[model samples]
Target: MMYDCNLKIYQTLNVQSEFNIGLLLLYIIEGSSNISINGKTNMYKSNDMIVINDLDHYRILSSKKSVIACLFLSRVELDKFFRFNKKYYINKDKLDLSVLKFYMNKLIVNYVNDQSENEKQNKILEYINQLVMTLHLYRKLDGTIISNNIDVYSGINYMYEHYKEKLYIGKVATQCLLSVRRFSNKLEEVTGMRFNELLRNIRLSYSAFDLMYTKKLISQIANDNGFTNESGFITHFRDKYHITPAKFRKQLENDHYYPFHNKNTTLLRSFEHINDQIKYLTDRDVDYVSIDINMKNKIRSKISTPNLLIYIRDIETLTNNFQQSKLLSMRREIGLFGLLFSHQLFYELYQSNFENNKLVHQMFSFSLEHQFDISFEVKLGKNQNIEEFTLIFKRLLNYLTDCTYFYGQRSFQFYIDASYYQFNRISKIIQDNLKESKVILVLNKQNNYLAKRMSHKVNDNKQIACKVHHEIDSDKDITSILKNNPSLNILYQPNIPNRIESLISIFKWSIAFNQNISMIIDDTWLDSMIPSQSTHLMIKELQLNKESHYQLFELILTLKRLRGDIVYFNGLILMTHYLNEYQIIIFPNMKIFNRLHQRININGFKLGEIEYRHHDILIKNNQLIINSDGDTHQNMAEVSFKREIGKLIVQFYTSPYAIKHIYIKQKIN
Candidate 1:
């Protein structure tokens, strides 16, 4: 590491500066100044800061005087710590340079104190690393960072959507309207993978999903995903995953908590959601339940579910039954943590009922009965006028204040339902009020706000999350979302996928990338609570019904147990190592649904008591053997199983989602 002592200390007072060869960090010490960087002008007041990249031109103008400390560091050196991609830029509105300012101040003091060059170099390097981390840098594909080139992304997108078909660099280049050579260069720049390499990854990623989620044969999967032959596909799969396709599938199955295709019919039916099936599952494991309440629905009997999220479509239903619902009583007795209703209904209620109205007072009473958080789904319609919204917002504050008096300040959270543009308007209003409560700006699938860096400064209490009404199962889409909205949480609404396995894969992707997510499954998607006829048949056991729904719930409960550091995550496998346990979620990334034939081998785990399908699973001689026909096959490949290491391998069976839970009695000593 090298530091140019000549550029160590500088005081800028209404002067222009250019960073043609290195990065410059400008910190405002006193007074206020107008600064322009790369043609974007913003006011830099006391404690304000900005990082100007190399080759960027910036100018400062102060009316009286301003003390600005500028530290210029070689960008080439910074690249050793971070890629410093050209496309990465901190928007003026989105900049949170407080952390950077702290480091910059320390580095400046070191320079002023005349520290040793090596010491200064080490400190400066620490500062540079901190700056990059604070920015929440996105991951790079292969080695190349995400490119901003529309053509390059377009080319990638073209390849992604049609990777199943025969693809050539020329065909994709032509689709992106770029020459072969130009497209090849751009693709390499964006992915750090050549045309064939990138295409193979795309195919392999999809094929991997198929391998886990579908029952497609290796040859068919390879052929469908555009691989010329099974051997080539196996070679590529092994090259990327470091395992043969057969072995990879086997490992996923053996590690699963419960095999989806269990041979025993009696064991499968035991997990189905019958008459109190939801209650049974929730009693065992479930953090919260998202249930809808309508005007016709009466105050039903309450179950001992820990947390409740009451979804009220309109105010009429809320006013009609919310106060009377057993949920309110449950909140007081046990504790239902949260309630949700639409903002439209709230506005209508306020307009219909005067201030200090009886209904509003009663609503506040029920909410204040327990210290549960209230979330209002604030939806902004297309034709909604800002003036009208502002007026309603004023009334909302008054309404919130009345409740705040009872519920205490900052107890309410606003769930703003808005498009990308609408979010900007409502967020500004909320911020303008100086409200410290948590605000979640919820966006829809059509809104690409997640991909674009938000221009609004998200306060400490505020978090923005994208809420999609549909299922996002594509690996590419998940990767793109995680990369673009590194700070945003994800909320999936209405229904869990038809297949629990798909969701397991999605959850793995989120966990692997260290992203926060919420999945809400509405009652409607459960296909009615009516119990289906019990047949001693396997096919009948695995149909999509309430049983399967509850099974999904059980799977969610199991998934939540995976809490710790994500040691490794590729598209195919996710490894999470916690203090008490280490969990692995392995799924194939196929776009289609098919039945899989699997032979699994479990290794690296100490065999203890195993809980699978309510039967005692024994590991003999470090090998677990089970045939497809409810019989033990001792001839299978033997793997090491140690008693010192216990693992929970949850496997999803067809029709019913069976969870295999292995609890380690002792921690690693």
Candidate 2:
């Protein structure tokens, strides 16, 4: 209940994928990750404090000999904890050098050495007592005292704010109207470090984080963080850590796998993907849904209380296919859906049951559409407090969703048919946050009333969008449109052979210069429209990772859908990557137009409307040109680079993994 100064094992083994509430993990060391409180399976490394909240699954990725000080309990349980012990929780200010480390190590030792129930319970209680004290102190210090006396805390906040920049102590001292020596002495007395040394420490800490958290070049990190030179930063970093930055990172990775660091890493996140990391948490008879889309095989597998991936194109029966996985578990509730499981289609039982529960696998395939439902409850193996965990789980999901999509991080995209309604709602929210920021809207065709309404919100204080489409009559039309609807501007967009040209047209009219666009997908295919190359750029904009295949796929497919293609008729690129398990054909550009034809009219979808006839596409002189085979060249990387007929040509590039050796060598040393 009350966060004791100790650690407790909530669950000893792996568990189900469900969310939790009021769970926070404190990091003992520096870690890697851009944690958004919204999604599952985000990467996290050592020493990152994470707050777990709501979600469809739990967050339990890899846990090393990681000693984590977790605060978990219902509000009622926490009240009881506080009632029993008051001094256990600590304030951040009171968390000084020896005591924090001492308690941390104690929790680690206790959890490892003692398997006895009584010992575990005793230590858990002790840990909780100490933690409550720390939390209470943190609140009193952070919430009440700081707000009341802003001036006293302002200096500390200011230091933290600009610490990442190339901090000039001389300038800072001047601002405080003190002599160099006086400022130096005062700062050291206040924060316990010499000014320059403090600056160095801050820079080094940032550098260390950049090394672990980002894949940026060393030079880039040094330059961005205001280090004079990479070598200078390297020297200081080595002096501080007794190892090179590279070596330190190598050590971090090793420490995670082997016992090296004195601290442990805990990822505080929503409980959605927790099951993947944990091996023992089981499912309650509660109902839940598992959505699995496998592109390689173009299959959507289903399992009730099932956590397995299914690729629908498999020759084996769903039951036979998952037969092996069943042996790994003694208890499981499994079911199948789709055309692959047609034999069991007529069996109209509400739910099927197996005596000795083992593996769970389900499949279904419908020509037009395939739908199924599953419900299950993920339980924290340590205890059975469903209501409490659910609250945390839900909160965590909110954070994750923000991290996954809404953030300025290259997390979303702009599309031909992004909703004006969604855009307007998002605009209101953004306007509240950035009053002076500019907004842009690019419509494919619906550029009349909706664009006019959204444009009115834009002004000198907050610039509006430059609307564009192919229907305007001459330069006057573009000018007239913007004048009449001062809230918006108009640009020309022609349905032509050149997509790049069209995009260039849109970019040219953007008043924000580099204002990032958030493209909401078509109403019918929202999830399907979330993936694309444009989405990749959005991820870049948001500075988020492109590691999530599902996110990437979703983004790209959404782009395809916007392009009006048959999205799920066949397998997608990812489905192809997953291989013969799914069927994937059709170019993205073609897919869009065809889908539009299919949906908008009865006699649409005729041939000769697409760029790629086959799968191989061509890229020459930075322009996309079609080849005879549709996209036959899609899989072929530029084999070589050369000049042919005075044109800079792609004589060679690379096939997948072909240049991996060169890439790795360059990446390594």
Task: List the candidates' TM-scores in order.
Answer: 0.43, 0.25
Q: Model 2, stretches more than 4 Å misplaced?
A: 1-24, 27-145, 148-166, 173-190, 213-220, 256-669
Model 1, CA-based lDDT: 0.52
lDDT of 1 by residue, 1-669 (tens): 333321232233555543233456667655677889757899878667767643345766765344556655443333333655443334434453544554555555444444676786676666556555554343222324223577776676577668888888899889889999998887666555799987887687667667755788999999988999999999998887777888777766233212111122111112122224223322321111111112122222211111234455444433556234544443344333366766656777657654657867666666566555677778777677877777877677767776666667565667877666777677677656637666787655555545465635555666776664444544455467667666666665544434465555556555545567665544233221222233453354345443355445445544554555554443433444444454544343222111112212233444345322222112121123433355544322222222323332333211011223333333433
Cα lDDT tens digits for candidate 2, 1-669: 111211333211122232332234433332244333334356655434444421112434333433233444332234333542222222343333232333444454444442675666576567555644434434332334324323323443445447766667676766666677877776655445677776676566567656755788888888766689989988987777767877766665233221111223333323333333232211111111112232233223210110121212222323452322321121122223112111122122113332122322122121111222211111132233545544443342333244334333212111122345544544454344444333444443345445445554555543334434432332444445555553443333223322332332333233212222221111112112133224544654233222222333222222232211111321112111111121122222211010110110112111221121112222122233333345444423322222223222212222211110000001112
CA-lDDT, candidates in order: 0.52, 0.35
Q: In model 1, what lDDT does residue 506 have?
A: 50
For model 1, state the Cα shift of residue 76 in Å.
Answer: 43
Candidate maximizing TM-score: 1
